[model samples]
Target: MKVLVTGSQGFIGKNLLAELKNKEFPEILEVNRKTEQSTLDKYCKEAEFVFHLAGVNRPEDQSEFMDGNYGFTSILLETLKKQKNTCPILISSSIQAELDNPYGVSKKAGEDLLFEYSEETGAKVLVYRLPNVFGKWCRPNYNSAVATFCHNVAHDLSINVNDPSVEMNLVYIDDLIGEFINALNGKENTRGDFCEVPVVHVTTLGEIVELIYSFKKSREERTIPNMSKAFTKKLYSTYLSYLPSKQFSYDLKMNVDHRGSFTEFIKTPDRGQVSVNISKPGITKGNHWHHTKNEKFLVVSGEGVIRFRRIGTEEIIEYFVSGNKLEVVDIPTGYTHNIENLGETDLVTIMWVNEYFNPEKPDTYYLEV
Candidate 1:
């Protein structure tokens, strides 16, 4: 399919065009403010589907709103009409169109024009009255507060919260593209003259700020947010994408001693914790058994021998592990286990426990393995 996307360099345009290319659309025509009329004429004549995403939200002069949103739309449609083309056209409108403002008025005028054209030519037109759209690539300090907040928080800058109680209706970029693709497949969620993205999230302005703050603090906390919630998961991923390239790495606290060091990598309330343990040569660790704090240990450096014995039985089991052949040794609840460094170099083991340690109610008990 030959898909023509207006505002092809914009946030939504970039996302949609990438997805279209990924879907293996044969040909794509990109149009932007700088696009020549001759190129638009050719694209209008050849495009099988038109994503009318070009619009002006912020302009120094108010008249430019109409010129960009309504005027450009008129030009595109008229060119399509002159070419006698009736391919499907999907327009990205805003919920503000219902209000009486310059931008809203321009968007509404564009919608009116598309409807009139659809009526006159009987061409398929899907008008989307989108809420605040956000995700990666959205321009900061633009129309989307979510984008501004994510960017500001990721950069350690202050975010303006004009109204803490104000709730925002957000449509993710991926969700918007999914809806657009559905419209392309002739399966639009339409009602009257407008179409809708099936999935949207609602959150208060204050909560959005809090969520982003938590994401930044996750580095120091060595933890992750609750991912079972759909909105949070998507928002967190979006938040991470906004982090500065140089800020990607964060330091973790490591405890070092003669037996080497141990560091907690990440801790989650429901998923337990992961830690790195380094044992010095000729040193042994974990001559203990747990009632329920089972663990999985994988030696990633040097060589070690992990020995285990049933709590009440005399039978002993031993497993030799090395960096050359990585393997995980499971420490069962009723088994006494110990890992001893056998190589000349220190042994580094990645460990995962079913739960984090609690000094008040430690499940471990010292026992010879």
Candidate 2:
């Protein structure tokens, strides 16, 4: 079904769009404050549902919040009311709407306007009050506490917490997106004028901070250096993996060709041959070296650390792997290397080699680790 989604550029909106697309929603008409009227009207007319999610989420000025959130929503509702053919309207409200903050007040006003418009126009309306949603591709900044916390922890930075014991409920972004898709599909019957809707309550700030701190502490205890890109991706991937839904995991595995079976993707025609297996936790692999081959790998499943020593070099490189990321280190013809599964689940990988596999005279030479 065709759906028009406002605030298409925002975090939640972007995630919702992806979710809908993944579910094979026929078409998505994206709309935002910057979206032109002609474009908005075109999509609204063709859509079977309109998800209103645009407007300023956290404005520095209270008035900006009012104008951007409440005012913009009013205008959109008015426009929809005038449509020759109306569709169900879903407003992406915030849990903050129940609070006293300006951002919350504006969202509350926006919801009120949606109800009023639905009453006047006989349009179906659904409101979703989202809590602290976290997951992949989330921006780390002042706008999102979870993102900021994850960012700091991924970088080995200390997390400052006002209270470390409070607990809060966290709704994964994928879960929130699933709810929106469910709403659009009419999986849940709607009452007249408005629906009671679903609200996800997240943990208290202290609890959230502690969770992140625990991850950081674990990484440190393992003597894993935060290797920028690879490590950050690993942490984020792990965070997403913990979400209580298989929708994302399934899609990711498909995209990465992770079928719980070994597969090899040749990087160059003759330079390398690479194969990977998704093994259970605590399984140690690759305690061997090549006399003439070099290799590289990226962890695509659970977390782990690699310990390697180069010939004629007293220093050893200890690297941690997590998430979905690429890590490269040369074997220098004859150096001992091995990786330990530090995570609880199977360790997965996309490994690359400098030469094709040969059973006999195979580049690999066994070494004691």
Candidate 3:
């Protein structure tokens, strides 16, 4: 079905478009702020579903709020009303509309305009009043307190609230998207009905902040090497007792072994090795090569192409490896390579490396093949 999404560049709009794409919905016309009225009308004419989301939620001036929120929606509704075939238009209103803020007042005006237009012209208008939404890809400066808390927690900063007791409902962005999808897929016979949509109260602000604190604390605990004196002493005693020879050197050594054949060993250290594995069929791994570290690969299973290009040169090298005929191939530093798994099963490889990986100072460079 053809769907037209307005304000497709905004935070919520971008996410909603992604969700629609993932669902394999056909023909999603993204209408951004730069979209002209002519262009919008053209798409709306062909669309079976129109999601009117173009509007400024927060404005510095109250007058600007009217122009952005109410004005933009009114124009869009009028355009749809002018169409020969009336399509189901879903308007994303805000819970703020029920409140006394200027932003809320403008949204309420838009909502009223939609209902009036719907009644006069037999337009299928479904209004969704959303609460505070939170999830991945959320921005902090926006009207989402949960997102602000998440960002603060991610940076290991303590969250301080002006009113910790204030209870605010939180709904996941994906859940909000689900509600939109359900409304979109509902039968046409239920179009004109003024449905009191369900509001999902996922969590309060206090609970959300506490959850962030707990997650941050857990992450911090994992980083402490020597947890306690008693634990360290016990570990040392066990290590000494396990040694078979008395002539063993005081030099500490660590060895790590990775399970599975698909992992390509890049560097082998005393304790462990760095590895890379491509699980998707017909998908390529790194397109870049490292200059400072040597990499060894053993294809455990499946089949794929290992393509490499030398640094500063356009020369390309290709290798086809499979699980049964597994061999350790050393990719020297200064060469860029990516592995493409060609088999149905996971194309696994074990990489062994001596140094820890760092993206910023990466000795790796990419070249187009």
Candidate 4:
């Protein structure tokens, strides 16, 4: 299919073009702010489908709204008409078109013109009146509050929220792309006269800011946010994408001694915690027993022997472990256990506990194994 995409450098247009290329669509003609009129005319003549995404939403002058939105639509339609090309054209209209503001008025006028053109030429038109759309690559501190909040919080910058309770209806960019591809395949989700992206998340400005702040703090706290909620999962992913390239890696506080270092890697409220432990050669650790806490240890380097014994038993059980053959040793409650590095090199082990350790009541007792 010979597809023509206007505003090819725009946030939505960039995402759509990437997916089209992934799908291996043949012959894509791009039109942007720098595209020449003659090139657009040639593209209009050969385009089998058109994605009209260029528009002005944040113009410095109010008069530019009509000129950029409605006026551009008129020019594109006229060019297509001159070539007698009546391909399926999908226009990205805003839900604000239902209002009477300058930008809304211009968008509504463009929609009206597309409807008229479709009627006159018997062409297929898919008009999507989208709500607040957000995702990765969206410009920060602009029209999208979600993008601004994510960027600001990730960078430790302050955000101004005039109305904490203001509710916003957001459609993820991936979801919008999915619906657009559906329209390309003639399977649009139409509601009355306009098309809609099926998935929408309704949230308040306060909630969005709170979640973004939590995401920022997750690194320092070695915590993982709850991702069961679809909106939170998508929002967290978007927040990480805005992190500075130089700040991609963060340092963890490692507890070090002659026996080596132990570092907490990640902690979750419901999934317990993971830690990395390193012991020097001939060093023994964990000569203790837990009342209720249990753990699993996997030696990833060197050689070690884990010794275990029931609190009331005198017999000691030993499990020899080595990096050559990976294995996990379970530490059951009420059993005194200790791991001793037997190799010449340091022993590294990954440990997973059922719960986060509490210093107030550790439930640990000293014992010999």
Candidate 5:
């Protein structure tokens, strides 16, 4: 199908085009500000479906709102009429269309025009009165507070929150595209006079700012964001998209000693912690038993022998491990355990503990295995 998309260079348009290309759509007709009238006429004649996404939200003069939003829409509809095309036309409108502001008035006029055109030509019209839409590629500091917050936070810049309690209804870009694709498939979720994106996230400005800030600090804390919530997961992905290219990588603290080094990779409050341990050749580590803490050790490189002995028992258990044949050794509670590097090179082990180490409690008791 030859799909036509206006505002092809915009945030939403770029995302839609990417998804369309990914889905292996055969043809796409794009119309941007610089596109010529002759080309638009050609696209109008050839298009099987239309995504009328071009509109002006911010302008140098109030008169330009009507010119860009309603006037351009009128021109497009007239051109389609001239071409005798009555394809499905989906328009991106705003909830503010119900208001009396100049932009809202322009958007309302555009919608009225579309309705009239649909009535006259019997064209399928899908009008979406979207809420505050957010995600990757949205312009920062212009219209969306979420975009501004993500950009500023990722860049370590300060953001002003005059009213942190201000609530917002957000539609993710991916969700919007999903709805658009559904409309293309003739399965639109129509509600009264307009169509809906199905899912909307409601959150306060303060909460959004807090989440973005936490994402920035996550690198330093070696922590991952809780992915159980839908909004948080989407917001976290958006926040990472705004990170500067040069600042993509951050250093992790590695504790180095004569035996080798250990580095904490990731820590979670409920899921415990993961660390990378390296031991020099012929070195044995972990001559201790824990009262409650338990761990799992995987030998990922070189050769090693893990030895274990239960508390108040003389019996010893051993497991030979090597990178060539990977296996995990479980260190049970109340069992004194140690690992010796048997190979000539350094031994690398991946360690996972059931809980984050606490200095105050220190459940470890020194014992030989």
Candidate 6:
């Protein structure tokens, strides 16, 4: 099928084209600002489907709204009529069309024109009265509050929230693309006056700002945002996209001593924590017993012997492990434990604990094992 996408360089237009390519659509006719009028005419003459996404939402001149929104629709429809071609054309309209402002008026005018054309020539038109569509690739500080918040927070810049109580209805770009593909396959979600993207999320302005801000602080705090909800998952993904490439990796706090270094990897409230422990040759560490907190020590590199002894008892248990044959030794509750480097090289062990360590109320106490 020949798919013609106006404003192909724009956020939604770019995402739609990528999805079409992923689906292996044969031909795509991309029309952008730099593309000549003659080229658009040629595309209209051959397009089997059209995505009319170009519009003037943030024009310098207010009068340019009508010209770019309504006037451009007129030109595109006229080209389609001149060639006597009618394909399934989708129009990206705004929910603001329900308002009485100039931009809204222009968008409503375009919608009316499409409805009239569909009525007259039996041409299929799907007009989506979209809400604040946001995702990766959207311009920051331009239109979307989500985009602006993500960009600013990722860059360590402050974001302004004018109305904390104001709630926004957002649709992720991936969801929009999925819906567009559904329409292309003749399975659109339509109602009386327009179509809608099925998945939508709503959050107060303050909540959004706070959530995105926490993402920037996650590395320092060693915490992760709650991702059980779909909205947060999408928002987190979008936030990561805005992070500078240089800031992609973060440093972990390591506890170093003469024996070796113990670096915390990741910690979770529900899933406990993981760390890497390096032991110098002939060095021993963790001569301690936990009342309730237990751990798993996996020898990942070099050779090691993990020793465990029941508290208040003389019995000792030992396990020999090495990098060549990986093994995990569990430190049971109420058992004193220690790990010793058995080889000439440093021993590296991956450690997992049942909970995040707390200095004030550590369940560990020094003991011989």
Better of 1 and 6 by TM-score: 1
lDDT for model 4: 0.94
| Candidate 5 local Cα displacement, residue 317, angstroms | 3.0
lDDT-superior candidate, 1 or 6: 1
TM-scores of all candidate predictions against the true structure: 0.93, 0.58, 0.58, 0.92, 0.95, 0.88
lDDT of model 2, residue 260: 41
lDDT of 5 at 273: 90
Over 12-99, each residue of candidate 4 has an lDDT whose tens digit, in order, gives 9999999899999988999999999999999999999999999997999999999999999999999999999999999999999999
lDDT, candidates in the order shown: 0.93, 0.69, 0.68, 0.94, 0.95, 0.91
TM-score, structure 5 vs. true: 0.95
Residue pair clashes in candidate 6: none
* lDDT tens readout by residue for model 2, 224-330: 22325342334445454333343232211122333244555433334455566565677677778777788777787789888887755667788888866656544
Q: Candidate 5: minimum summed lDDT over ten consecutive residues — where?
A: 264-273
Please identify which of the two predictions, 3 or 6, would achieve the higher TM-score against the true structure.
Answer: 6
Model 4 TM-score, all chains together: 0.92
Give the per-residue lDDT digits (tens) of candidate 6, residues 192-287.
868999998988889888888878888787777767889988999999989999999998988999989999887766778889999999999989
lDDT of 3 by residue, 200-254 (tens): 5544566556655644443333211232433222222322232335423332222
Q: Return whichever of 3 and 5 wins on TM-score.
A: 5
Query: How much is 331 displaced in model 4, in angstroms?
Result: 3.6
